[model samples]
Target: MNYSKIMFMIMIMLTTLMTISSTNWIGMWIGMEMNLMSFIPFINKNKNLKSSRAMMMYFLAQSIGSIIFLFAILMNSFIMTPIMMNEFIKTAMVIGMAIKLGMAPFHSWMPEMMSNINWNEMMVLMTWQKVAPLYTLSNLMNNWSMYILIILSTIVGAIGGLNQTSMRKIMAYSSINHMGWITAMMITQTKWFMYLLIYSITVAMLCYMMNMHNTYFINQVSTMNESMTEKLTYSILMLSIGGMPPFLGFLPKWMAIQSMINTEMMILMTIMIMMSLLTLFYYMRMISSLMLMYSSMNKWMKYKSPNTMMVSLMLTINMSMPIYSIMSFF
Candidate 1:
């Protein structure tokens, strides 16, 4: 492992933690700025033009968000009435953080940026980068506005990916879809941290598997003549990612649905379920392509085994919930 890269990532997480733990807006802004700077160095480290473009877009988006946040903080300091100041501040903060979180209307940058980077960077972008902004939004934004954003994100994520063929772009939409669920859970004050934890781990496992197999596009899976075991392994991964029943991925979705129903958000839950089904359609499409090839293969080559660590992590992700549930009785 590269110690310097690991250290930079640690700093990134530390700064996000700093933002979340800060008491004042200025402290939080400073922490977020630190986090942003640390992250810029980590993106597009390969010196390619596409990666550079992605980094630039990410920087501009983040910088614009920071400016808006700081302006809101400054304006709030001068306003005499708490009521007026709170309104302006909340509006500005929500818009700013929405852009940072790549919530829809401000979400186009995400798929474009994801397209330029590799799976590892995409994993970080999808999961860890969401921590501070999302938590901050949960703490500060009004429930009504958050709900609206949640619906918009789910709708956009579902529709936008319908025509996409790239794996990273598909994952980008998937992240947006999951964001809607995450926001809904946060709005309901459900166990959002638990949701985030499982989401991050599942995304990490999927990205790791994708990285190992050098699979970058949906077409690549169907075109590359892979072993039956390889095809089957990835098929299960795709199913798990789509939140099929009995998989670890389904656990969080089930929890969120239960929470939504309990809150009498039946209509919202119905829309979310329908949109989630749209995402699953493409996931199944990808898996079917692989399965079709798997069924026709003539002779299987003896495979190079996966890394022990990779297999262990995959098993842990797939089995962690079931094992925990079993252990609960003891």
Candidate 2:
């Protein structure tokens, strides 16, 4: 809300644009470094110890990634390389991006960081902060190592969220899982940008609603003094986020799956599908807690009316499938 925060946000967007638009690795690396600097201040805006810690962790992780990235860029730029050295450079580049993007195996920092930040910060961190690294990674050659990273990311993301009670942590792991899918889109060279756009919108909506209600943990869902309609709406949104059919979130995944099938990536497709089901299970668990569990019946408790804009957004997400189907007929 303050000018300083607004400035940092603009810097974040500008830096991401710079990275994605750059023609060479060095330019992209500079953009990434600026983006990191901008985000650190944004993350620490609250001036609390928790936010400070998260900021430091993010800085350290990104610094390491950027160093590796810079080293690879310099190696590829200056040194005349043989086939083996070229492959080594490529591998280093991928690892650097993976670390920065918090892809699995380098992903422990993400959930830990997200769990410490507020919902708004979490939204930015999960969505916009990922653009530069993901775009960079996508432009790299698709190789065997990428497939291994994809499988590991999907597996770790799905399994990691199963036991998490913190909403932020759950979303963090969900982001990792979705990152796997997005990376697959890159390999297939399908609609990765489209997928990323849809993901950003979905995450923004979910974070908005969660922040509005000040909801953090799964248990809080059951205890909220909300009407049945409101609770049901929230549950539906969660299901949509879990990529349930006929929801907006499912559209991109459906497209990705079709692309994978067309490309004959049967093994990877199967694993992703199974992991998706696992994600859906935990989402359903949260929904069930909201709808089925009995809460304390306190007549004096004040009930906040649901935002009309948020309700409209929810309706749009829920009805996207039907809309798409109707459009396809045209």
Candidate 3:
């Protein structure tokens, strides 16, 4: 890349380091803010007015929720207790964090924002950045509101993602869906971190591949003629997102649910499994659209390999995570 790109990556790296190092909630929140601001410049690098507008809304939404986070911190401190507090402030703070993370009920901006952002930026948005806020919150409090909020997030994330047509939007929903799964697993932090690590690896690899393929616009892939290899690639990617057994996505969710089931959360597990149908169908839409073989007039008729060394490594990661997790567990 260019100097600008190098500087941007450095900005993100430092922000990530800042997040992991912050000892307190406010410090962590500020680190997240720094990360958010540092990354905004990259969101709409094409300088498209659409990207700009979406970025503005995203920044505003994150900022507003952050204000509440700060406010809750102030109130929690005023209550003459350090981190522990009563239900009202606790719930408010949890909701505020949820909103920042784009969990449902507060998720209106996410799909809209995703529709406009590039996947490289979307990469950072999805993985390392996400783990920070979540880990921070889990470290701060282990309370009932967090559990309820996490469950609600999983429900909204899985269901809300059903009707998406844009690739970014689909991935956005996927991010939210993982957010829910991670949230549910957060109740038992140590075990959930394993889930999170597997999740971040799979998602990062998948989204990176999507970006490299320039699968930025869903219409571009769906409405255009797709080559056999492209179609096969798309099919594999979609199945992975749907959490098929062979793909990486399957491992974390499966592990987390098995953990939940062990604790007798059958109802919640049922809800999560059922809502997954929503994601499954939509993911299949991409597969079906790509499954159409290339015709003379198809856009992807000239398909050359997008397979770099990275794609090979990513594919290996995707195919290997589940098998390893299963073998290690059982």
Candidate 4:
């Protein structure tokens, strides 16, 4: 319970929210820098050697991205008209956002960085920390570059996760894969917000479960000897994250696919669906171990109870699926 770190985290969120709500590019950059600086201190709160190294790595990468972003902004400022802005400036902004968002080609830092941080910090890295950069990426006005990133991200995110046994790395790739869909949704311009919201909630749920169980590796998941209720709760959450049917995580993918179809992006939709299935395959692979119940262990396991708070949180997150639809009516 480090209150200073908590305050910094709150500042990060506030600054990012400010960035998104800003209409002026310079004000947005100011807010973005505040967000980055606040996160650096928060991440460095843990004094582990690995954490220190990770903080340095993250700081360097983010600084470089910020510099590039600032250059793009400066270049754009010189333009007298919106139509007068050059492709190079737009592409520069796109590249900067991609780096910050950890999209493919610029994504090497994410998995490595995630492995070095605590799971709770990793949750912020995967979800909340991404909001401003992703919103910026969506507004870059470079559709062609974004399209290329969408293809590259889905391909890289899928292939990269195929051989990983580290839960954090798997989640890193999952984040990238979801980013591809989010970027694609940007083309439709109206649906990316919903996808981002759902993705954030689903990711938060997965991270909370993982942190509660103290699970780090995929193999660790299979070996967890939790009670039936606990096992089933986490398993369902994992399946939902992998975009399986009848789960909250599936809703975003469903909406994304519909958006793609509406835009006649059949190939992109097919690739996203295929990659989603691949992700689910790996989740099922890990879950197979949990599903194999021993008859002798059943009696003892039935009596065990999991954390009440976590169970309540998971239930609330799961209920978001129906709640999302109900809210859509308004």
**Superposed Cα deviation of residue 207, candidate 2 (Å):** 0.5
Rate residue 86 of model 1 by lDDT.
62
Best by lDDT: 2
Off by over 4 Å in 1: 1-4, 78-85, 225-227, 294-301, 304-309, 312-316, 319-330
lDDT of 3 by residue, 27-71 (tens): 777887887787777776777788898789889988988888788
The per-prediction CA RMSD against the true structure, in angstroms, equals 2.9, 3.0, 3.4, 2.4
Backbone clash pairs for candidate 3 read none
Error of 4 at 69 (Å): 1.2
Candidate 2 ranges beyond 4 A from true positions: 79-85, 294-306
Give the alpha-carbon lDDT of every model.
0.81, 0.86, 0.72, 0.82
Give lDDT tens digits, candidate 1, residues 48-120.
Answer: 8988998999999999988998888888876533245566578788888888988887898999999999989
Model 3: ten consecutive residues of lowest lDDT: 293-302
- lDDT (Cα, 0-100) at 305 in candidate 2: 51
Q: Give the per-residue lDDT digits (tens) of candidate 2, residues 188-266.
A: 8657988888889888888887898899999887777665556766777788778888888888898889889989999
lDDT of 2 at 241: 78
lDDT of model 4, residue 240: 82
Single out the weakest 10-residue window by summed lDDT for candidate 2.
297-306
C-alpha lDDT of candidate 1 relative to the true structure: 0.81
TM-score of 2: 0.93
Q: Count the backbone clashes (under 3 Å) in each candidate.
A: 0, 0, 0, 0
Q: What are the models' TM-scores?
A: 0.90, 0.93, 0.86, 0.92
Using TM-score, rank the candidates from best to worst: 2, 4, 1, 3
